[model samples]
Target: MPKLTLDDLAKIREKTKRLTTIRVGGEYRAKVCVHMGTCGIAAGARTIMNALMKELEEREIHDVLLTNSGCAGLCSREPMATVEVAGQAPVKYVDLTEKKIKEIFEKHVLGGKIVQEYALGIGSEKTDY
Candidate 1:
């Protein structure tokens, strides 16, 4: 592979700083993971990611960040996602469609509330992390 130029290095540094800021001073402002395995894409992970980005923008919460990861060992719930707040426990939300993404954003991200019905409990055996 070609060596990275100075400009490329600078851009990478800028992005690193931005990502650090989004972590919100040791507290995670928000963490959204969109499962991106083959099954997940088939189940609309793309739409979920789009909705999440739109909601984060609309809420004007610059600290939140979005990411994609491989399957979370739950292919039956292919498009599964997890949200983790600074102090609160992480919650897994399954069966995500675009509409549900908005609801999750509103209740969980903006309001600092967990949609319990949709949330797989923090201590559930399925939780690997």
Candidate 2:
């Protein structure tokens, strides 16, 4: 292995931080999980994820954990995401577009209000918090 430069270390640090953010319970204000399964990608999940990332970067928002998971089990709703705000139930939004997701990030993720128009449902399957 080659010696890691300072720039390489910085990149590693950022990647680590992104990966570990979800584990630091109560530290983050919200969590956005984009479903990136094969169907999801074909339906444009990548675009949705990228738009969310751009929103976060432009807003300099650090308290929201952005991540991805496998199929949401509803391939018909391929490009889906779940947004969970602290102390609130997670809302699963389906049939997402980049434009709609950016609105969700702004209203639901940042403003703490569910965007009912785009949401499939509120609350998720039982999971240990």
Candidate 3:
């Protein structure tokens, strides 16, 4: 690689700062995991992921992170997803659609409220805190 100029160094520093900030402070809003295993793909995981990305972008939530993971052992209910907010329990949502993913982003992420009706296994009852 060529020697970095002052401007290049500054850009690198700025990107580093942004990445650190995102890692440390972003989890509070929501952590969304879209299962993208074979079963999930067959059930439309791509559309769900796209919807989530669009909603987060439209909302201007730059801190929010989108990730892909393997199956959560719920292949019978393919396209399963999970959303976990900082200081709150993670909730599993089954048979997800793009519409429902958007609803989850709004209600759970923006509104700070869980959408219980679609949750498959909520750990709210077991928590002592």
Best by lDDT: 2
Q: What order do candidates take by TM-score, descending?
A: 2, 3, 1
lDDT of 3 at 72: 70
Cα lDDT, all candidates: 0.77, 0.89, 0.78
Which stretches in model 3 have alpha-carbon errors above 4 Å? 1-27, 123-129
Lowest lDDT sum, 10 consecutive residues, model 3, at: 120-129
Which is the leading candidate under TM-score?
A: 2
Instruction: Report clashes for each candidate as comma-separated counts.
Output: 0, 0, 0
What is candidate 1's lDDT per residue for 1-129, written digit by digit as tens? Answer: 659988999999977776577555644577777888888988889989988988876765667768788777778886888887767777888988888878888889767898887776673224345
Q: Candidate 2 regions off by >4 Å?
A: 1-26, 126-129
Residues 1-129 of candidate 3 have per-residue lDDT tens digits of 679988999999877765576666643466787889898999999999999889876765666667778767778886877887876787888888888888888898777788887789874222233
The TM-score obtained by model 3 is 0.74
Query: lDDT tens string, model 2, 67-100?
Result: 8888878999879999999889999999999889
Query: Positional deviation of 3 in candidate 2, in angstroms?
Result: 28
